[model samples]
Target: MPSVHFAPIFQRHLPVQSLEPQGRDLSECLYALFQTYPSLKHYLLDDQNRIRQHVAVFINNQALKSRTNWNIPLNDNDQIYIMQALSGG
Candidate 1:
């Protein structure tokens, strides 16, 4: 299982602040999370099933480079972080 942590902004609206999702890749892990919190899907992904433009996902403290590619493999000890991206001056 991989540990997934959500930023405080997201956590405030969700039931959990973190989770240990069961999956081999990012997509599967997100799917498992959506199963538990269906509403989260709308906040994290767009209509195309891609990560929302304002959202950011980091794996093992490294930011994900491809928002459309959710197949990134995960290790049992991996740490996944999801948050709202900050922008503007």
Candidate 2:
């Protein structure tokens, strides 16, 4: 299982701060998470099923490079992080 973590901003709206999801890839993990927390899907993804513009995703501390592809493979010990991107000057 890969450990998934939500940023503090997101945590405020979630039941748990972290979870270990059984999935082979990022997409699967996110799907599992949505199954557990249906409301989260709206926060993370848009109507087109794409990542929300204000959200960021990371795997093993590295920012996800492809917003269109969520099929990135996950390892048993992988750490996935979902955060609300900060912006403003």
Candidate 3:
């Protein structure tokens, strides 16, 4: 199973979690993680089940280019990390 870790930057907005072993694939694993931590569903993804704008997810050090709909494949022992994007004016 692959491990997907979410950042605490969205904790206040939603009391979810940080690290979780999310089986495989992005959608399925993410959905499972959210099922364990429901509050994360709304914060990490929008009503249409798409990734939020201020969030950045990387699979094995590669940025998710698919944006709203990602197409990255996963295998056992893979690591996925999610972080909140930083912006400065």
Candidate 4:
């Protein structure tokens, strides 16, 4: 199974630590993430089942165009990343 690891941006809140999820695909991996932090869906996915504007998902250093698209497929060693877009002054 592949592992999805969250970045340190999550440390903005000390109580919530980083997450590592195991699954074979994007959906399953995200499901594992949701299981760990149920409230995370509201921050990432929207009502239409799409990733929110501020949310970003990447696999092998490439951005995902759709949450339910074919581009998100994962393999045994895939490393998925989920993060919010970074903005600076």
Cα lDDT computed for each candidate against the true fold? 0.92, 0.90, 0.76, 0.69
Task: Report the C-alpha lDDT of model 3 over 1-89, residue by residue, as the tens digit.
Answer: 88777687866644555566555578778878777778777777877778888888888898888766655668987888888978789
TM-score of 4: 0.74
10 residues in a row with least lDDT, candidate 4: 11-20
Model 3 root mean square deviation, Cα atoms: 2.3
Residue range 26-73, candidate 4, lDDT tens digits: 877777777777677667788976778777888878888776563356
Candidate 2 residue-wise lDDT, 1-89, digit = tens:
89999988877468788999879999999999899888899889999899988999999989998777999999999999999998999
TM-score of each: 0.94, 0.93, 0.80, 0.74
Candidate 1 wrongly placed segments (more than 4 Å)? none
Candidate 1 local distance difference test against the native = 0.92
How many residue pairs collide in each prediction? Answer: 0, 0, 0, 0
Alpha-carbon lDDT of model 3 = 0.76
Candidate 4 differs from the real structure by a C-alpha RMSD in angstroms, to one decimal, of 3.0
Off by over 4 Å in 3: 11-18
Worst 10 residues of 3 by lDDT: 13-22
Candidate 4 residue runs with Cα over 4 Å from true position: 12-18, 87-89
Q: Which candidate wins on TM-score?
A: 1
Clashing pairs in 3: none
